[model samples]
Target: MSSKALEQFLDENIEDLKSRGLYNEIDIVEGANGPTIQIGGRELINLSSNNYLGLATNNTLKQVANEAVASHGVGAGAVRTINGTLDLHKELERKIAAFKGTEAAISYQSGFNCNMAAISAVMDRNDAILSDELNHASIIDGCRLSKAKIIRVNHSDMDDLRKKAKEAVESGQYNKVMVITDGVFSMDGDIAKLPEIVEIAEEFDLITYVDDAHGSGVLGNGAGTVKHFGLQDKVDFQIGTLSKAIGVVGGYVAGKKNLIDWLKVASRPFLFSTAVTPADAAASAKAIDMLMESNELVQLLWENADYLKAGLKDKGFDIGNSETPITPVIIGDEQLTQKFSKRLFESGVYAKSIVFPTVPRGTGRVRNMPTAAHTKEMLDQAIATYEKIGKEMGMI
Candidate 1:
C-alpha cells in the first residue's frame, strides 16, 4: 500500500483541484508531433507543437542524427564533467555561438535546465533579478533557486522597468541587479522591445538577460530578438532552446567568453548532468547550419502565419495582437475555452486551450502554431472549423 501520509495528502489536494476545475488531464499522442499528428489513429491538423520550423521531422536532420548515432553511441556515457563532453557537444556549442554572434556558448540538457543552471551560477542570495511579469515558469523557478530578490516589472512596460531599475540601483542594498525578460512573449506572441530595454540597462549598468527560446528561429531572420534589434553586443546573456525551433533536446547560453567559461565550470546542471545524446547534438548542429544557410524556411513560416492570421480574422475570430507566428484565438472563460478546444479536436484540429497560470484567468486562449510545413489548404480548413464551432457555441 502507498504511504498513508502521502496518499491522504494527494487524495485531498487532487480532489480540491478537480472540484475547482484546475486538474490538468494529460493527453497521449501516439507518434511524432508534425504538421499533422495521429491521436488514437485519427490524424488531425496539429497546431499545438513548438516545432516552429518543422525541422523536428525534417529529412536532412534525421539523416545527420542517424549518422551521428552510427558513429558515436546512443548516449553520452557520463556526466559532462566526467566523460560526456563528446566532440559533437563541443561542435554544437561552437555552432551555437556563431549562430548567436556571441563570443562563446554553453549547452545544457534542456532549456529549463539551462535557466536553472545559468541563473544560480551568476546570482546568489545578495543579488536581485528584475524579471518581466509574464516571463516563463522556468525563469521564475530559476530566479527562486538563485535565492535572489525577484522584482516583477510590468509586462513590456518600459516606464515601469525604468522606475524599478532606478530604484534597485539607488537603494544600494543588492550586490548586483540583473534585468531578465523573454525575447518574445510566448503567450501573447509580442516581441520584446530590446532597444528600449538595452538603453535602460546601459543607464544603470545592470546585467541584461534575454531568454530567446521562442525568438531563436522566429525573429531576427532566425538569429533572435537581440539581433533583430541590433542589440547583440549590448545584451549580456542570450538564452535559447534546441527543442523549439532547433528541433532537438537541449538549451544554450551565449555570451562573452568569460561568462560562458564561468557557466561551464560553475553551472550545477552542466557539471553534474550528462550531456545531450550524440544524435540530439548532431541534429541541433545541422539545424543551425540550415538556418544560417538560407532564409527559405523562415520566409515560408511568415507567409503561412500571415495566411492563417488573415483567414481567422476574416472569419470573425479574435487572433489577438501577435507580432510572431503564434496565433491565439482569445476565449475568455476557462470552461468555454476547454470546451472550445475539445470541439476543435473533435473537428480534427489539435489547437490546445491555455487558461490561467499560463495566461491571466480571463485571457484564456486557443493558441495555434502554424508551421512552415502546414499547407494553405490545412490552414483554410482549420479556419473554417473555427467559424463553424464558434458560431455553433455562440463564441464568435
Candidate 2:
C-alpha cells in the first residue's frame, strides 16, 4: 500500500474541495490542438489553446522540425554548461535577438523556467522587487525564490507603482530594486501600462522586466509589448515564450549583450538544465523568421478576435474589457461557470472555465482564444453555440 498518511491527507483535502464545488476534473485532448480538437471522440471548436498565430500546426514549422530531427536526432546531448549547446541553439538565439531588436538573447526550457532562472539569478535577499499584483504564477514563484522583499503594486495602477517604488528605493533597506509585470495579462487580456511603468523605472533607476508571453507575436507587428510602445531600447528584460504565438516549445530572454552573457553564466537552469531539442530550436527560429517577413498572420488573428468579441458582446455576455485576443465570458459563480463550460463542451465548444484561485472568487469566466487558424465559419458556429447555451441558461 501507499503511504497511509499521505493518502489520508490527499483524501481529506480532495473531499473538502469537492464539497466546496472547487474540485477540477481534467479532460484529455484526443488529437492535435488546432482551431479544432477532439476529446472523448467528440470534435470541438477549440478556443482553449495559446496557438494565437496557429503556428503550432503550421506546415512550414512541421517541415523544418522534421528536418531538424533528421539532422540532429531527438535531444540535446547534455546540459548547456557541458556540451548541449549546439549551433542550432546559437542560430535560434540570434534570430530571437534580431526579431526582438535586442543586442542578444538566451533561450530556456520553457517560459516558466525563464522566470525561474532569470529572477533568482539577479536578485537575492538584499534586493527588493516591486511586482504587479496580477502578475503570472511564474513571476510570483520567481520573486519568492529570489528571497527578495516583494511589494505588490495595484494592477496597472501607475500611482501605486510610483508610490511603492519611491518607498522601496528611499528606504535604503535593499541593495537593488526591480519592477516586473506581464505585458499582456493572460486572464483578462488587458495590456500593461508599460510606458508609465518605464517612466517610473527610469525615475527610480529600478530594473525593468516585462514578460510578454501573450504579446510577443500578437502586438507591435509581432515584436512584443516593449516594441509596441516603442520602448525596446529602454526595458532591461524582455521575456517571451516560443510555445504561444511562435507555435513551438521554449522560452527566451531578449536583452542587452551583457545581460544575456550574464544569464548564460549565472542562471541555474541555463547552467544545469539540458538545452531545448534541436527540432524546437530550429522550428522556433523558422517561426520568428516568418513573423519578421510578414504581418498577414497577425492581422488575421486580430480580425478573428474582434469578430468573436463583438459576437459575444452583441449577445449580452459579460466579455470583460479585453485589449487583446483572449476573451473571457464572465459567469460570476464558480459552480455555474464549471456547468457552463460543460454545457459548451457538450455543444461542441472547448473553451475552459477559469475560477479561483486562478482568478478572484466570483469573477469566474470561460476564456476563448481566437487563433489565426480559425475560419469565419468556425467562429460563427462557436458564437451561435454560445448564444444557444447562454439563452438556455439565462446567462445572456
Cα error of candidate 1 at position 113, Å: 0.8
Q: Count the backbone clashes (under 3 Å) in each candidate.
A: 0, 0
Compared with the true structure, the alpha-carbon lDDT of candidate 1 equals: 0.93
Indicate which candidate wins on lDDT.
2
Tens digits of per-residue lDDT, candidate 2, 1-396, equal 799999999999999878766888988988798999999999999999999999999999999999999999999999988999999999999999999999999999999999999999999999999999999999999999999999999999999999999999999999999999999999999999999999999999999999999999999999999999999999999999999999999999999999999999999999999999999999999999999999999999999999999999999999999999999999889899999999999999999989998999999999999999999999999999999999999887
Best by TM-score: 2
lDDT of 1 by residue, 356-376 (tens): 878897888999999999999
TM-scores, in order shown? 0.98, 0.99
Backbone clash tally (model 2): 0
